[model samples]
Structure formats: C-alpha cells, structure tokens
Target: MTQPVSKTSVLAGMTSRALVIAALVVIVAACLPMVLSSYQVGLATEVLIFGVLAMSIDILAGFAGRTSLGHGAIFGVSTYVVVYATGQAGLSPWAGFALGVLAATAVASVFALLAVRTSGVYFPLLTLALGMIVWGVCLRWTQVTGGENGMRADVRPAALMSHSAFYWAVLAGAVVVSFAMWRFVRSPFGLTLRGIRDSESRMRSLGYNVPLHLFIGFTVSGIFAGIAGGLYAMFNNFVSPSTVALAQSVEGVLMMIAGGVGTLFGAFVGAAAIIVLENIVSSYTERWLMVLGITFVLIMIFAPEGIIGKLRAITSRKVR
Candidate 1:
C-alpha cells in the first residue's frame, strides 16, 4: 500500500510553494518599470494602491463578516488629511502620512462604534449613509477641500520624483502591507475574527467579545485603507471629492470579490485585472462601464469564489 501522507508534510509543501510563488511575483514586479512606459508604470502603482484598499475590504467582508460601505469615507478622510498637512500646513511627507493614517483610524473607529451592532443588510445600509456624510463634507468643505476642484499636494519625497522611483516606493509599500495582512489573517486574533464571522453568537457564548473584535478589525482595516489613500494622493498629487464617494467604496469591494474574497494576495490580482481592463477597454469604446458590469455579472455566475479562489480549487483537485 502507498504510505499515508502526513498533514504536516502537506502543509509544509504548500507553504514552500507559496513562498516560491511570492518570490517570483516580487521579481516580476521589480522588473516592470524596465519594460513599461511611464503611464503604464503609474497604472501599476495605482493597482498596488487599490490592491491595498481591496485587501482592507477583504479583512472586513471576508474575515469579520461585515461589509462596509463607509470605507471610502475612511480612505477619503486620510487622503484629505494628507493633502492638508502636506499642502496647507507645509508639513513633511512623513508627518502627513502619520496624520492621514491617524485620521482614517479615527473615522473607522467612529463608524465601527455606531454600526457594528447591526448585521446583514442593515450593516451595509448604515455604512452607506455614513459614507454619504463624508462625501457631502468633501463637496461642501470648500475652504480646505477646494470644493469640486479638489486639492493638490505633492507628498512624494524629492528622491522619488521619477516615475520609476515612485513605482518602486509604492511596490515596497505594497509588499510590506501584503506581509502585514498575511500575518494578521493568520494570527490568533485573526482566527478569532474568523470564528466570530462564522458564528457570532457561538463565539459570544464562548466568552469572546464579538463587538470589540469587530471594532478592532474595522479600525485596522481602515489603517490599511488609509495607507492606500495616502499613496494614491501622492501618486496623483491631488485629492478630490471623487476619492471619497460611494462609487470608490463599491469599486474596492468589487476588486476584493474579483480577486478572491478571503485570499489576501488575490486583491492584487483583482486590482491588476480591473485596472488593466479599464485602460485597455476604455481606449476601444466609450461603453467600458457596460463591459465591466457584464464582466462582473459573468464572474458572479461562473466564478463566484473569485479568480484566485477558483484557481486554488483547481489546484487542490489536481493534487488530490
């Protein structure tokens, strides 16, 4: 008879494969600037930023079972804070970064405090309302936000003026954020969050503070979103009301779904797909949104678990 395979050995092999794949991905990312045009490099950087945002959404939607529509508020708040600090207050880029993240944390905390008690459709509705509030503020806060014109701030460090340098900086940030998120989802706290997601009442009966855990998760997710927002602002050297709109939050969630809801690195895959599609499809037709909607519908019908999740399932079946 064939020897029985040990689960530990199987896990070890999977881990080894994952590490190798990760290293290969990094090598490819590092080489993109050499082959791509400046605009394409910028698009790549946008993918990294939006990937982080999508990962943050994964934290809440996949792990915490809380799909927030207010994340755009948190993201926009951070972007505006960074713009204010860097442009209006004349602070250093580092200082703006700190303040921007802090602002996002604060907004997330408030949203969590008010909304975590609700679940299901109510949760999303509450978050949508809260996000609309932020959008209204961005539109009306003319003195600081520049009204509809938006605000511009050069948050890029002098050393990163070149497109290649900025792309590398964003790539480095994406890598660090990815690693941190990976650790987070695998940590004990992360497992607790997942447990709570699976059965909130059961976890509560087991003496877990469900609301507190969700609140913390939401805040942490917001921090990652904030990081993405700051990077986005730096990339465009501008912040506008559009950044904080409901559409922005929806796009982030869409990216999460497209990539694979729970798989952290899958967010990048989704981001790349969406960004590349937008660039390529828009050039050919003005009906890009229609195409995107059709694509999403098709994915929902054919690959509901997402691109990465589908691939994982195929790989597992092959291994079996």
Candidate 2:
C-alpha cells in the first residue's frame, strides 16, 4: 500500500533531517549552561572531551579500518605535557596547549614507524605494547607525573576563569574539530583512505603509498586525541597514570563501537551514552560496570552496527 521512494526524494529527506539535527544541537548548546546545574554542565564538558577522543579513534578504526589500543597513551602523554608546561615550567596556558598537542603527535608518529608495516592483530598488539610502555612511564616517572597522587596543573586563562566560560570554550572546540573531521572524511584524501580500507592491494597496485597513507591517518588521529588530552588536562587541572591506562584505551574503543563505527557523529553519541551511565548509574549502584557490559552485549545482539547504524538502517528501509 506504500509508494516507492525515488532516489531524489530520499536525498532531500536526508538533507532535511541533518539540518534539523544541526539546528537542535545549536539550540541545546545555547541553553545548556542556563538550564543545567554546575555539576551537570561539568559532566557535559567531560562528555565533549571524551567525544573528541572517541572521534579520533573512529577516524582510524572506522574509516581506515585500523584498530588502535594505544590511543590512551597518546592522550595521557599530551595531558602530562600540558601539565608540565603550565604547572612546572610556568608557561602560559596557550603555549602549554600547543606543546601538549605537539608532544602527542610526535609520540604517535614515532610509534607509527614500527606499526605502519603491520596490519590486523599485529598492529593492535604493537600499539598495545606501545601503550603499556607509556603507561609504565607515567607510573614510574614520579617526578614528572606525580605517580599515583598526580599533579594538579591549572591551565585556565583569565578569560576562562569560570566553569561556564570553560564549558563554552570546550563547546567551541568540539564544534570546530567535529566540522573539520566531517569535512576531512568527505574530502579526496578521505576517499583515498576508504579506498585503501576497501582494497589495500588494489590501491597499492594503483601506485598509492598504502603504508604512508595509513601512517599519516594514524598521526592525524593522534592530533585530535592530543587536543582532547590538552583540554582534559586544563579541565581536570591534574595528570596521572590513570589517564594513560589500558582501560582508558578500551573505553575509547567501546565508545566508538557503541555509537556507530565509521560515523563521526556516532562518536559523540557513544561518549554521551557511556559517560551518562558512569556518572548517573554509578550513583545508584556499585555494579554499574556490570550493567554497562550487559547493555553493550544487548546492543551488539540487536544492533551490531550501533545506535547510529541502526537508525541509518531504519531510515534506509523507510526510503526503500
């Protein structure tokens, strides 16, 4: 009894839906600080921070088809750099920010020297080892990272002295980074990466430097992870081994998978879902992790591609 949807009509519908979603997000951002409690707003800020981290991992795992378990090291390293730059060296917050991100990029590039040659389980294993090495450093290097106690590094500028102000800054950062990522994933370079993901040998036969492309993508992903880390350092005003732990790396991967792999917007969705449960559900029960694990299993059973992927599937079905 239903009419078939033409391709033109489906395209128009998708565009309209995207515009509505964008407008709604803008409205929420504008109203959040005024409506939410300080603690809630701070939690939201954390979501955005982790969203950036998850999105970075998504770029490689989703688009480039390379799963990395060492992202937390890259993230934690940046945070420590920012902390050291501002807290220990007495550098300006802005300068510390730059150095923090640069350090993360450098570390990721260095790791890529060994990782770029491998794929599949080998790449993840190498990255895991690299991550563990960084984690050990953060733990053993007491003078630099303050070991278990951690060092409180205040990197807030005069303009962002208040929590609300900092939240706005974070919101702006998330927006800019998300827009840039969205553009990058649609660009010719992104298309080439996808081609490599689909058929590495074919791309290589076409004279594409497959390893070089993957390496560059890996480094670029680290850049965003570093930015998230820098923001996290300033936001938390602290640095420690926990930031670089293997658990945090696993969390990033879980977020990406929960939201929807290969979809940038899904990264934020996944972060929100996970962070909300951590903050809210943990308050009610001590076994929140178990509950979360159960939820993840159910989601995978019903919607393996994730919430966004499932939604896309439904939309596609409707269009058909």
Candidate 3:
C-alpha cells in the first residue's frame, strides 16, 4: 500500500516551492541588466515601483475592505515633498526620502482619522474629496509647487546616478517593501483586518476595534505608497500634479482588481501586465488603451478571482 504524505511534508514542500520562486525572481532581475537597454531597465524599474503602489491599494481593498479613489494624492504628495526637499531645500537624498515618507504617513493618518468614521462608498468619496484638496494646493500654489509646469530636481546621489545603480537601489527598496507587507498580512493584525473586512458588525460584537484597525491598515499602506512615490520622483527627477491626478488613482484600482485583490504576489503581477501592455504595446499601436480595456474586461470575465487566486486553486486541487 502507498503511504500518505504527512502534514509536515506538505508544509516543507510549500516552503521549498516559495524559496525556489523567490530565487528565480532574483536571478531574472539580476540578468536583465545584461540584455535590457538602459531605457528598458528604467521601464522595468518603474513596474516594480508601481507594483509597490498597487500592493498598497491591495492592503486597503483586499485586507481592510476599504477602497480609496484618491490614493494617488498620497503618492503624489510624498513625491512633491521629496522633490522640494532635495531641489529647493538642498537636502540629501536620504533625508528627503525620510521626510517624504513621514509626510505621506502623516497625511494618510489625518485622512484615516475621518475616513474610518464612514464605511463602504462614503469612505472612498471622503478620500477623493480630501485628495482633491491636495491637488488644488499643488495647482494653485505655483510659487511653491510650480503649478502645472511641475518642478525638476535630481534626487539621486552621485553614486546612484547611473541607470543600473538606480535600478538596483529601487529593486532593493521594492524587495524590502514587498517582504514587510507580506509579513504584515500574515500577522495577527492582518487577521484582524480581515475579520473587519469580512463583516464589521461581527468583529465589533467580538469586541474588536474595527475602525481603529482599518485606520492603521490604511496608514501603513500609505507609507508603502509613499516609498513608491519617493522612488518614482528619484527615478524621473521630476515631480508634477500629473502624478496625483484622478487617472492615476483609477489605474491603481485597475491594477489591484486585475491582479487579484488580497494577493501581494498578484499585485506585482498585475502591475507588470498593465505596465507592459501600456508601455510595450503602445509603441506599436495607437489603440493601446482599447487593447488594455479589452484585456481588463477579459480578465474580469474569465478570471475574476485574479491570476494568483486561479493559480492557488489549481495548486490546491493538485495537492488534494
């Protein structure tokens, strides 16, 4: 008779599988420098940066059951802060980065304070209104923000000025953000967030602080989004109102939905797919937006659970 596998064996197998996947990713990122052009590398770096942003949205929509349509404002505000500190104030890159992230976190905390009072659609609308306030400041305060023309500043230190050097730095930051978020979502706090997401009433009856947990989750997510903004400003050496626009917010939502909300891995996958479709496909076709729309529709229709969710379903079946 064939022996059945033990639970320990299954756990060990899963652990090994995860390690192998991580190794493969590292190897691929390492080798890209050899084959990819400078521009291509920059583009790839952008995908990773935006992947961090998408994951932030996932933390809210996926884990907390709170969706914000104005998340781009948080990202943009941080970027602007970094740019101002570095260019206008002559602060060091590291200092600028610190200030930028903290500022974003502060902004997020303020928003969360009020947003947590509301639920469902109201939360998102409140966020949207608040975000528009930031945009208005950026636009009207031309003397400081440069208004519509935007501001240009080199945020990279001399050592990281090279394309490859900057890409590696960004890659490191992205990796840290990804690992930190992964650990967080698997923690007790993350579990609490999930309970709230599933049913706030049930969690409240259990004596859980539902609003508090959601506010914390939202604030934490904003920090990561801020980090992405910092990297983006450094990468492009430009900060503008465009980064905080409604269109950018919509794109972030689209990314989370496409990748499988709640899956950190799915967020990155979705970012890659959307960035590739937008950047690569647009080079050859004038109707890239239409193509992207079609792709999104198809994914929603055929794989509503998202790429990662579908894969998990397959893996579970095979294991069983």
lDDT: which candidate is best?
Answer: 1
Candidate No. with top TM-score: 1
Clashing pairs in 1: none
Worst 10 residues of 3 by lDDT: 1-10
Q: Tens digit of lDDT per residue, candidate 2, span 1-320?
A: 01111222343343666655665685577478899999988988898899999999999888888889999999999999999999999999999999999999999998887888998889889999999999998899897788888788778788997878888888878877776676677777888889988998999999999999888988988999999999999889888888998878878887888899898878989999889988778898998668767876888789879778888999999999
lDDT by residue for model 3 over 1-320, one digit each (tens)? 00111222343343666755765676677577679999889888888888899999888988888888778888888999999999999999989999999989999899889999999899889999998888889988999999999999988888998888888877777766777787678789999999999999999999998888988999999998899888888988998888887667767777787788888767778888788879878888888658866876887788778777778889999999
Superposed by TM-score, candidate 1 places the C-alpha of residue 31 at a distance from the truth, in angstroms, of 1.1
lDDT of 2 at 74: 97
Clashing pairs in 2: none
Assess each prediction's global lDDT (C-alpha) against the native: 0.87, 0.85, 0.83
**Better TM-score candidate (1, 2):** 1
The C-alpha RMSD of each candidate to the native structure, in angstroms, is 5.9, 6.3, 6.1
* Candidate 1 lDDT, 5-29, residue by residue in tens: 1222243343766666676777789
